[model samples]
Target chain A: HNGSVFHPGTIVFPAALATAQAIGASGRDLLVAAVAGYEVGIRVGEFLGRSHYKIFHTTGTAGTLAAAAAVGHLLKLNPSQMLHAFGSAGTQSAGLWEFLRDAADSKQLHTAHAASTGLMSAYLAKSGFTGAEHILEGKQGLAAGMSSDSDPSKLIDRLGTRWTIAETSFKYHASCRHTHPAADALLQVMLKQDLKPSDIAKVETLVHQGAIDVLGPVTDPTTVHQSKFSMGTVLAIVAHYQFAGLQEFDQHFHDQDICSFRDRVTMVLDPEVDSAYPQSWIGKVKVYLNNGEVLEGRVDEPKGDPGNTLSRTEITDKAMRLAAFSGGASPSEMSAAIER
Target chain B: HNGSVFHPGTIVFPAALATAQAIGASGRDLLVAAVAGYEVGIRVGEFLGRSHYKIFHTTGTAGTLAAAAAVGHLLKLNPSQMLHAFGSAGTQSAGLWEFLRDAADSKQLHTAHAASTGLMSAYLAKSGFTGAEHILEGKQGLAAGMSSDSDPSKLIDRLGTRWTIAETSFKYHASCRHTHPAADALLQVMLKQDLKPSDIAKVETLVHQGAIDVLGPVTDPTTVHQSKFSMGTVLAIVAHYQFAGLQEFDQHFHDQDICSFRDRVTMVLDPEVDSAYPQSWIGKVKVYLNNGEVLEGRVDEPKGDPGNTLSRTEITDKAMRLAAFSGGASPSEMSAAIER
Candidate 1:
């Protein structure tokens, strides 16, 4: 997790589902494959370290190998074949952050490429197509080309003993993870003071450098997808609507009031937060009211984090809301599917 | 063309052909698109500089953009759309040298992925899928993330004035490009001396650091593909037979005599050659005979290089041989196609 923020589910789930369907695998097999993908991808992200996330997109790069691990597990590949799959997947590891500057559609493409390419790699390995043996830490491997701060130890730290999938957090706000900490902290202040959107004249978020590195580029977001990366936009949406859900982002991200509130927000780099970062994302914000009143808010664990994880009921509700927003399924069908 | 050795045709031609066939484009259209691809890919590889090629495979990383340029040109994309296509292609640029260490099949996969992905980027851009505006030189762009010695000026230098497509080389030997210079030098020595394999006791190849960096890992190549990267093996094949072509490598690469000759070959880094590399590949070799006599051989330009390019007749012969080797076409069919 380090300085890198990625949704392993975006890469792993697609690969697992695709492989499971292709192979007629059971639901239990899919779950096991998903776990394998999560374990490999999360550790690979950690292994790549902070420097890699600075330039390379971890979800695309490490995600490729993660996808291979999942698909390979589903295929019941031998250890040798699995290593070969990683090698091929690592060779194809790619995705840069430049697209964020233009609000490009590359983010979605990255996940698709990772999942498909990784799936292909596992299939190739099963057919005896050899690949590099040491693609992760080798002299000319992914870390050698993509990361300056790679730690080989992170790749196999606890192995079977540690289930890193549990460490994954759900997104409470339908926005960038970098904004969630600040979003939660702002919500805490609003609830405590019973403050309305018009009550707070200015909001200052004290965040780690990682937030700025990722969220700093979007000065004026033109699209809903891009606005999610804008710290100010997320905070403004949450302040006005109480939640930065898909509907809020879709309909009101560019609304006049939200845009005005967006301009009233700023991010300041804090040393304490930066130092504790990756390991822990601590949110601290300062609020200035029109009545010459100032209030500070802090949230050590943002909602949906492991420490403040969502309950089954909350997850179910969130799933239903997502289905409704996307018009993916009717309520009865969604409930039936969820129950199954 | 600098320190990076790539077969631009491997990426560009495939993409151009695929796009042209899909769209029913003219042969002239395919030719122009290929030229565009070659120009963009070569410049990108040169701009990335030697540092990028050290770890990243130039053909895979730069080739993706090249493929995109070719396909984009074939699609008749406007400047903005072409730029967007490049942005998407660059974000997905990837391939590592670690695969070479294991004689992996990733090299073929790299070209396939680049060609397909690049083609897809062009189609996406045509559909108004926006990409980064300045993907190559942007803060989190391809160069920023993949290369430390990237030169921004080289990307646009000479623009329409210089036709880089003319600079591309044909591979005279079936082995890696790094081995070609020395292979030619060895051929020169053997021909001039009119000596057989038994006449040579030991041979030392004077090469650039790039050659050593690429060929140093294949100490005892077990596969025919791996043997191509082995400096010792390539030299051995060339010494025993006048040429190291596909047939020779396939059938005789693992022969005991060839393996013994492989052990007798050694590579020594030469300062003059190292400094002049990328721009010029000078071959210098020392051949020690069993009769206690030594001879020096030098070749300023390797066979198949722009300066010493193959003639049309030789090219046709080579194509026919290739078709025969792969059983892809009959001699008459090849000639008919070549005539067209």
Candidate 2:
């Protein structure tokens, strides 16, 4: 929501799976609950507006309400009960961006806490527990406490007609979503010129303000995970390898050659890009070559966006690679789980 | 912290007991952990200031850090790890006043989640997990997201010289702390005048803004828990029974006579009380008798305050009565547990 990006699945899936399994729910029931969670979570995130995203992590704050919606749906709660769940969930909504400055594991804990707390809210509501009915728009509410630019209409806009779950994007590059546009743009310029990393004198990414706000903190990333948030590192990997994947980040993020390339990359705020942001991430980059020639590359939609989505095969391959990298499952095991 | 009143034991004791039992820590260690939790939580709560208290629940927001401090101490974490735990805990600090509007059970969930989440953060930090080192005062931290009137000095005020744990008050009335001053004052007026419930025509309470902010929502409370937040209900019980204890609230809170008395009670804002409030809750009430006689009562310190603490015997009796009321423990079981 707004300019901040986070995976709704991190919170919703846990709540859906837990509630579904506990109640012996059908697969169709689980899927419906998941969709409801995404819709409500996304709407809430959007409602909180830009000011809220500047400081609070939407995934953690809105994720609680999303998780509750999914569980409440699965439980077949009455309207009043569902509202109580929202009240309970909203009261406990919390997450901040401070941890990003330290590359903290707080991101995982935030989603985990949101999922569990939201699930608990649904269960409590089922037991006739009361909660604030006007929690979202009340005098003392989520927006009142957390946002300066909240819009109530964003919550119910296109309500049943629009499905926000379909709008969620896949991560094409193994980096922060803020860096994806620039990474893709850099790769485009490098591919068009048939040039190597050494041929580039400087590369300037014409970016949005949100990108700067989120990615500007990491001047010198020391860890692999932290390096993913550094726009310079992501653009450097893209310029050299064409694909800023997990392997590239893990193996060469801090390579002397990559670091040298990273130093050459800079982010410049562009009015056009800033205006289009959150709604549309417009990628525009200027590549200055050693031969005194400047080339421009632009992409209206970066890869993995709704308009430029990944294929089913690409999704499968990405999932398999991630599973293999973590050693979470073997190839056959992963395939069997996916099939199930 | 600020003008908000919350039970520190609700968040601290659970975390300390859980960690102590999990690690098989000594009784002294557990006690030390609880104290550490109280000191840090109280400091953080005070640091966030009055603006934070208006919308957020102090126990829930500051409780996470307090719980983490206690658990981290028990885990023998290094300074760096302890700092990381604080960061993780701060990122998850959340609770809102919205739920109180509906007499919600969210209060219990808030403390429960704080205890568990804080415990988890400490464990994660112990395992080398990094977190924001400046979560309390960072640009995108707790104060930035939650407070408009935060004072950093409150966090370090007295530091090692004074123990905030010593300042926490016990509840003398089975009602919201916001109503205690008025309840005590009303009881005093009736006692001084040798008046029965039938003799009083009206009771006016001079209260602080914080009390109004917290207690003003319940115009006509319907539940036992909700009635505790109604100044009128508490004062009415006090006028009738000379006490607003658990039994009084449970049995007579909704009685016809009590309801009639409740209608005559009113709360008016007082600048003197407001200025001294949070630091010192002073009670002042005016009782207008049926015969046109007026009696005034005042108390600098209410019962169960640090200046007017309950005796050991009273504390024991209160505990036994509470346990018996909930059927959580028998008298023998309560005595044995207390002895152990």
Candidate 3:
């Protein structure tokens, strides 16, 4: 959720490096271009959309432009030349919608391509090549071609005023957003009822339609990637385990008990719940007891939403946990760096 | 333009650095993530149609997801966490249509944002946060939301077979692609006609519809960025000068003759030529003489296009020229590097 404030250094570094090496741009120019690129990239991207999930992936789409701008700015190109850089990047724009399929590795590649391609575009423009000027607004322009709905004004919207980097969200969980509420809810139910896996007969989950479509109807996930998308699998692990974390997902994805429990769990989809969407990732879980009793609990908002936002302390704690897993830094050091 | 296989290090280095630092990721993991990210990002992006310019900016849109996936992979998060990382990135996705709007700086920003946000998303997910799993395939998924025409299967079309990095283009010019054909055409006309600027009165350019829509309606551009997008500006400089390279773009963007000639040139949009489109970035230029004589030329393909692609020698020559402008390595050394 990038709100505002573009940091060109973010995209510039990558773009400039490639361009510099490509056309033998000086190292000094590369460094300067990198910083400038990030600033321009972030600023422009911020103007487009921060939380518009459906429109485009700002980092990939806009990042290329920023990279090109940084290179153009560094090379001291005229405004028209800069426009060619934009056109070059636009013609080469790309990113995919496959991450949602199974969270494949392509997600990470998007950034690399943008950075590399953008720098290439700038270098080409700098060398007296030409590109489209109306690449974004023409009949087959970026807006008309890439996005269904675009406010052309957004391109120049607050050109230098708002930055997008400021609004970006920092994650504390490694699971799907749709599943966080369920995880939190299950944890709470287990804590309140003090129940063990042995006492539970069947677990029923009611969640937003979006979540159901994404994480429901879990049968059997053979791979680690697929297991994370299975609501049934996630619930199975939570019901039988003390804590649900990265280790649980990685280690028990194919465990027999987890698999068995996943099959026993039933997920119900409700559109009414999905209406709240990103604002409140809501979920409800019912645990049927062997004694003919049903204990129901609902988590209307997950722990990371703005309403249920994680405190600074919570964020740091989570960062520390991840750092520990990566085996690189201590929680305190990670926390300090983030705070700074 | 990047159609051959080259070292991943060249492209991966820059993208990885921006991605890691922007998201507060550790430097140690950046390199590993970058390599892996490049492999995944390129492959996935290529699958989505590397040759098509209509769907989305593959490098920008798909690149973000690739960056996110790389970061997630480096962090070793399960599928659920990776999905969240991608979802976070999806929500923040965007790039401008302004490239077509007089070659705005938005083009460069596209790639920069993708790299930055992808890194950010992964870092967040690593911190034990959540995001949607069906970020791409859901009803409001990336494909459905951003693109009117998308092939979801393209996401994993050839998962591990082909890599996108191998198909990347390394540019040899600093101008717009549309103007490249015109530039070549003008240069050819100059060589053949041996005509001086004093002999030319009016320069009329005929180009494809895409070219006219993008680079036509040329105007006086103040910034170098803007000048690159102006076909008139590019043609004026190339037609008037004996040498055209990076230095001309950098040092002479505001030269009086270039500016004055830019004011005199007119670009006409030809509908009959529009049908050729992406296939042939064709261009025809007519120079009307003060003595009632006419010198006309047409280029069916530009130097960078597949049919008229630049040879290794040409690429090196361009690189050398850029090096001379940057006052760094000689063209020979730069050329060697590119060849290497």
Candidate 4:
């Protein structure tokens, strides 16, 4: 595990699963490819920098390489073929932050496209198609177009030594990762006080400044998916529903409780928390109670962080519940697949 | 057709053909989509600018949008659905100039991915998936990530009044468009002087400055496809074989005679040619004979230029030859498919 904060799961998870199914690859190959996805993808994410993040999503950019690397590994591509695969991947690399301003379901499509494209790139290379060898550092390369500032060393340093998948932390809340720390901090407040949503007059959350571009201004999401990015909606869901999970997201737009509570919940940038970012994405929650009592809580990191991991039981419970929810079948019909 | 210089065939041709096959759209719809591809793609390409071309192939970038527009039109998509299609297409838009450096078969791949992605985007929109509405103009939109300078008005101005596809011209030379003018100019030189490759000591060519970027400095290509971008190889193939056609490209890399004359040719910038660039892509060729005789020729526009259209018979001959070269089945097997 290394010290990168990018999320490789969106890129690697869908990519590996799809490619594994397509090729009938072994579990070992799948794991190896998934790991390669994280290592290769997250480092590329770092090179793209915060400036690139202002417009492009790393999952679409770096994710293409991750998917290609994983699929290429499974295909047993030689280095030259892999370079060609990367060349095609780089040429097709794209994902924009513009979707954040729209209520479109493009978020899911991003992962789908990245995964399929990764497989496609690998297949293209296997068919004897050559590609740009120095795709990363070429004059008209990903780095040149996407980012003015990037560290090539970060992309290649400890290529075989560090396993970045080890550093990847899972999400406990189903909302956007940026909204998690605030929701997590508020979860503690709700638990410790045992206060109902009505008992809270107003709620304020403190999050790092870097989240402004991502989770800003889209507070009144018309669609369920959009609610995930709305810090207000995420906090309101946590306050009223007690858990921010798949059901909560599905109900975000229609639920009157979440809607009403959303207005009372607000976020402000905290200098202290902003300084700690992105090394440590911290959140501070302040609650004004109707009973004239104020409650404050802080969390350096959200649940399931590398430093604060979910228990094996918790993860297993989530996986089982998610499998049941997303995968429609009787328990008898699904148990074997779920267990595997 | 409009005055925009972007190539629409790579984007619209595949996209319309595939979508037409998929949906059984009317011939009218297919033609409408192709026209939409040229108009929409060229405008988007304008916004992307030449700087973007340094990194991305416009066929893959603006081309994706063109494909989507064409597919979306055939699908009878409402304005909202079309917006979503564009949104999804923008997210996946990519193609790198890096491939040109590697001489990879990525050129074909760019067109393939653009076509497939366009079909995929439209299909997703039809299925009710959301995409960015302001994918081109949004804060973190395609223009932001791909280009530093853009003219958004060009993307929408006189959309119906000016048809960009009308300006589209065919290529007589089988090489890249940059090499076409030179190849055309050389054809005249060979015909006028009845010269052989052995009779030539050194030859010089004058082409637009922009052509320098496309056909520059790739003198020793190991593949036939790469030879398309090498101005020397294109010229030599014309000089020796007396014609630059698909069959010639298929044989360029392996020919010893073409390789021998490749070294004898060079390119230099001509201010007169540079000034007439987008308005007219002209080439001037000067052949110095070993016998101390000099032959010169100039072509203001290559064969198949809008002002110099290839004869319908010539087009049909090329098409028939190409069909026979690539199609492996019997005439009856093709008849059933060709009838459709």
By DockQ, the best candidate is 1
DockQ-based ranking, best first? 1, 2, 4, 3
| Maximum-TM-score candidate | 1
The C-alpha stretches of model 3 lying farther than 4 A from their native spots are A1-174, A183-204, A209-228, A242-253, A266-269, A285-297, A303-340, B1-174, B184-204, B209-218, B223-226, B247-252, B286-297, B302-340
Instruction: Determine the TM-score of chain B of model 2.
Output: 0.97
TM-score of 1: 0.98
Docking class of 1: high
Candidates' lDDT values, in order?
A: 0.90, 0.87, 0.63, 0.79
Candidate 1 per-residue lDDT over residues B1-340, each given as its tens digit: 4434667999999899989999999999999999999989999998998888888889999998999999999999999999999988998999898988878888898889889889999999999987888889999999999889899888788899988888767888899988989989988999998989989999999999888878998889988999999988899999888899999999988999999999999999999998898888899999999999998899988998888999999899899999999899999999999998
Question: Between the candidate structures 1 and 2, which one is better when assessed by DockQ?
Answer: 1
- Candidate 2 has an lDDT of 0.87
**Candidate 1 clash pair list:** none
Q: Once superposed on the true structure, which residue ranges of model 2 sit more than 4 Å away at CA?
A: A1-6, A332-340, B1-4, B335-340
How would you encode candidate 2's per-residue C-alpha lDDT over A73-133 as one tens digit per residue? 9999999999999998998899998888888777777888789888988998999876788
Candidate 3 residue lDDT tens string, A69-184: 87787678888778787787766555544344544444345566577667777777788666667776676565565544455675665656654333334443455555667767
User: Highest lDDT: which candidate?
Assistant: 1
What range of 10 consecutive residues in model 1 chain A has the weakest lDDT sum? A1-10
For residues B111-169, write the lDDT of model 4, one tens digit per residue: 88888888889888999988998899888889888887677887877878867776678
lDDT tens string, model 3, B78-113?
887887887766644544334544444555555665
lDDT of 1 at A327: 92
Q: Where does model 1 exceed 4 Å of error?
A: A1-4, B1-4
